[model samples]
Structure formats: structure tokens, C-alpha cells
Target chain A: MAAARARSEERRAAIVRAALEVIAERGYRGASLGAVAERVGLTQQGLLHYFPTKEALLIAVLEERDQWDTGGGAREGWRLDLLGSLVEYNAMRPGIVQTFSALLGESVTEDHPAREFFTRRYAQVRAEMAAVLRAEYGDRLPGGLTPEQAAPLVAAVMDGLQYQWLLDPDAVDMPAAFRDFLRLLGAR
Target chain B: MAAARARSEERRAAIVRAALEVIAERGYRGASLGAVAERVGLTQQGLLHYFPTKEALLIAVLEERDQWDTGGGAREGWRLDLLGSLVEYNAMRPGIVQTFSALLGESVTEDHPAREFFTRRYAQVRAEMAAVLRAEYGDRLPGGLTPEQAAPLVAAVMDGLQYQWLLDPDAVDMPAAFRDFLRLLGAR
Candidate 1:
């Protein structure tokens, strides 16, 4: 029974992987369960049995991707230099980054399934950034803005660099630009 | 004959307006010509007279929005303060900004119809930003980076702030955040 359950988990992981690939090629609106099923040599019914719904599968894919990036949880008091490393790491994985960016852009619409997820995620991220800033710089940053004020700028640069780098990789060096932002914050 | 031509032009503008509404609500992939035509009280066949294809209509809507933002022409040597004004102005029109953001996000997908438009647009925008930075700061800015090095960061902040603002408007003061970025650049 344990072996059977393990097999099921493996199948579920494969479905999420295929879904990411499909979403990378087609935007979330264009990605369909049948394409994901076919990619994994499973029927639509088989995919549904594991995910129950397309939205569920999308959530799983998002969670899985985040796990890969965050190591299954948020890092408390993550420093600016660590974020610079993550940005550099992201540059090596264009497909995953593209999929994540596309979903992020789509989530801004009123009814997108991922809307709440991204909205909540940013709130948490801003908080985490604030903690990091406070840990490093105390009450106020070198720019005279409080940690709360600087948090959004940190989040914005991370996301904004992804958009520009994805659009033109050669032109926008994501990590270097991020380091520049760090310098602006007076971080060493 | 002049009156007939003017009426035709009005019809084209109406179609573009309807298209923006549909795209904003349903995203580009989910939107259909039928829905846009229905919104403007025109049959799909009639709409085709104004825009031969959906892609053409999409392009028209984007161009129209650009016209509105650019004031029907590009600014020559636009200053940093002017960009701050543009960001502030964008906050006032949520619908237009949402549609543009949705399309910009979707354009990252390889075969998306807006891909080429965005790619070319960014190339132009980055050059314009470099020009603006050079005009304002000359060869080396206070941050010790060249205008060319700084242009992408400027573009990134403008777009990055949009994503953060779109996600959580109450938490992010988009214009003020932009002002913070300008301060980082040491722009007066």
C-alpha cells in the first residue's frame, strides 16, 4: 500500500511538471488539461483524478515552482545579497521564469484564479523584505525611508527586472541590475 | 464624401474602444471578436471592415492607448519628472493600465501576437530611457553608472512598480515609489 501511494505521488508530480511545460508554451488561459495529460501519456480522466480540477493543478504547479525557488518555505530575514543570488539563479531557467511571469501578469485581472494567491504572496513578500531590511539597517534605511517603505521597492525591482530581462536577455543583466538597486539602498 | 469618411473613422475608433474593454475584462486569450462587436453594437462582419483580423484590432487598441499616453507623439528628451507625472497619470486610469499590463505579461509567451510589438517597443523605450538619463546626467551619473547602464533600471522600475501597484494598490503608492527610485538615481 505504501508503494502504491508513492507511485501515485510520483504521477501527481509528473502532471505538475507537464502542466508547467504546457503553461510555459501557452499562457495560463491557453493551457489546457488535455495537453498536459497527453504530454504525460495520461487520459484527461486520469489527470482529473489526480488534480480534481484545472485550477487545482495550477495551484500545485505554482506551489511546486515556489518550493524550488524558496526551498519549500520562506526564509525569514532574507538579506539583499541572497536575493541577488536568486535573481542570478533565475536567469539560468528561462522556461520556469517565463511561466511564472506570465501567470503573474495574468493574475492582475479581476477574476483570474491566481489573483488571490499572488495578492497574498506579495503581502507576505513585502513583510519578509521589511524584516530583512530591519535586520540589516534597523529603523530607517540609508535613503531615509523606513524598512516598510523600502520593502516594496525591493519587491518591485525583483519583479520588474524579470520582465525586462525576459523581454531582452542580452540587454538587461538581471543580477547586475539587482545589485545596482542594492547599492541604491546603501547595502554592501 | 467627407462626412462618410468621418463616420467610418468614428466606427473604427468605437471598435477599438470596445476591444479594450473586452481585453481588460477577459484577457486577450479569453476575449473574442464577437464579444467586442456586441459591446459596440456592430456585427462581427461589420467590425472586420474596420479591423481585418483580431490581431489587427489588438494592435489598434494598443496603438490607441499609446497615443493617449504619449499625447499623439513621443516626447523629445523627456525628463525624469515627466516620467513621474506619467506614472501618476497612469494611476488615474485603471482600465487602460490593466489592459496594457495584461498584454505586456502575455507578450512573454513565445508565439503571443503581442510579442513582436512589445520586443520592439522595449528596444525603443530603453533607448529613450538611455537618452533621458544622458540628457539629465550626462556620461556618468552620481551612481557611477553610465546612462546606458542606468536606462534598463529606469525602465524596470517603471514596469516593476506597475506590477506591485496592480497587485495591491493600497499598500503601494506607485507615484511615490517612483519618486523614491528617482532619488536613488540622484535625479533632482
Candidate 2:
């Protein structure tokens, strides 16, 4: 039973990695199940053993990256560490942002898997980010900037910078950008 | 000759409006040239006469919106007004934040028209936003931040907020968020 579970986990990770590579090279629309399966050394049917549909697979890929980025929910105690970790994660998986946003823009339908993924992701990201801000500010962000107010701005900055980074990594000096934005938030 | 020019401009505007509506209703992948032409009471050939391809048409729509939003470059005055104008512009067309991101994500090829559009757009946006920072700080932002240091962060904050707005309009109070961020910049 342990061996079976381990193999399942390994297979899932392999699939997610393959999906990221495919998404990077071909984007969301251009990626195909056949190509992903071939990359993973699995037949389409074999790949389907893990993910039932492409939508399911896309959501899994997102969740997988989220976990991979977070390193298994290990961000419970620190705020600066969390922000720094996420910046690194985003910087590393830049293409995922494009795939994620494109899928989200199309996922307006309630039934689309990415809709729920994004909704949940936003909630989690926002909540955690807000928690970090509160920790740093300790009840004073000044200029009437509450944890509630600042959290979404933080998310927006990350999302918006991802757009900038998508076109030209050189366009924005990302780490410097993040640090400055953070400083602005902390200013009294 | 003047009448012909006026008619052509009107037709172009109509086509762009129709395209926006079509893309809004149908996902980008599902929005076709025929659907857009049909929406605007024109034949596909007529649409093609104005925009030779879907990509060309999409980029035109983005540029038109950009031009309309910026008041045709009338915000070329001082820095604060320019930044304030940007805040107001984003407040009005919050949806375009995601719409433009979605479009760019789908059209990532180096040859795609958005490649150039965003490249130039970033240059202009960066310069204007940097100018705003320079106006307030001159060289130093409170808390040891510099305009050269702060410009990219301001740009990132603007970009970041737009993405959050797409998922949840209420997530960030657009004008208020910008106001606070700007205040923080001025404080620096």
C-alpha cells in the first residue's frame, strides 16, 4: 500500500512537471495530452489514469506548482520569508503565470476547473499575504492602510508585475520592485 | 475626402467595439472573425478590409482603448496629474486589465502584434510613472527610497492591482489603493 501511494505521488509530480514544460513551450492552447503523455513516457490512457480530463490536469498542475512553490505549506510562521519565497517561486515559474492567467480569463464559466482553482488560490494567497502584512506592520501601516486594504494591493502588485515580467523580465527589476512596494506599504 | 476619412474612422471604432463585445461574450479561443464581423453588421471581407487578420484587429482594439483612456496623450503635463490620470483611467476600464492580460497571454509569440504593443506601452507607462515619482521625491523617497528605485515598484503596483481587479473588483478599491500607494511614494 505504501509503495502504491508513493508511486501515485511520483506519477502526479511527473505529470505536473511535464505540464509546466508543455505550457512553457506551447502555452495553454498549444499544449496537448498526447505531447504531455509522450514527454512523461506514458500513453494517453495511462496518463488518464491519474488525471481524468485536461481541465482536471490543468488544475492539478496549478495546485502542484502552488505546493511546489510553498514547499508543502511550510509558510506558517514567517511573513518576509513567505513574500521572498513567493517572489522566488514566481520568478522561477514565470510561464505558469501566463498559463494560469489565460486559463483564468477563459474560465468564467462556473463549471470550469480553473474558476474554483483561482477563487481558492486568491483566497489563500490573500489571506496569507494579509497575515504577513499584519505581522510586519503590527497594527500600523499608516495612511489608513489596513491589513485588509493592503493585502489585495500586494496581490495586485504581484499579478501586475507578472504581466510585466511576461513580456520583458528586463522591463521590471522584480526583486527591487517588490522591496520598494513593500517599503511603501510600511511607510507611516 | 474628409467625409471618407470620417466614415473610415467610425467604421474602425464600430469594429473594435464589436470585437470587444464578442470577445467578452465568447472566450478568446472561441471568438472568431466571422462572429466579430457579424456582430458589427459587416461581412468578414469588410472587417478584413479594416483589419487584415484577427491578431491585427485585436491589437487595434487594445491601442484604441489605450488612446481613448489616455485622452490622446493629453496627460503629458506634470507628474502627479499623470499618475492621477492613470489611476482614474484604470478605475474606468478595470475589465481591460484582465482582458489585455488574457489577450497577451494567448498571443505570446515574438511576432504577435501585442509583443510590440506591450513593449512600447511599457516604455511609455514606465516613463510617465517614473516622472510621477521624480516629481514628488526629486531623488529620495522617504525611508531611503529613490525615484529610480521607486519607479519600477510603482509600475508593479499598478500592474498588480489590475489583475486582482479582474478576479474581484471589490478586492482592491482602485482609486483609494492608488491614492495610498502614491501617498507612500510622496512620503518617501
Q: Which candidate number would show the highest TM-score if scored against the true structure?
A: 1
For residues A63-134, could you state the per-residue lDDT of candidate 1 as single tens digits?
898677777778564666888899898888777677678878887877788878888888888888888889
How close to the true structure is residue A1 of candidate 1, measured as C-alpha lDDT? Answer: 100
The chain A TM-scores for the candidates, taken one by one, are 0.82, 0.82
What is the TM-score of candidate 1? 0.85
Candidate 1: list runs displaced more than 4 Å.
A1-11, A17-32, A38-41, A53-55, B1-11, B17-32, B35-41, B53-55
Model 2: share of native contacts present? 0.41
Hey, what RMSD does candidate 2 come out at? 3.6
Highest DockQ against the true fold, candidate:
1
lDDT of each: 0.80, 0.71
Tens-digit per-residue lDDT, B44-147, candidate 1:
89888888877678778888987776678664457878989999998876666776777788888777788778778777888888888888889977766778
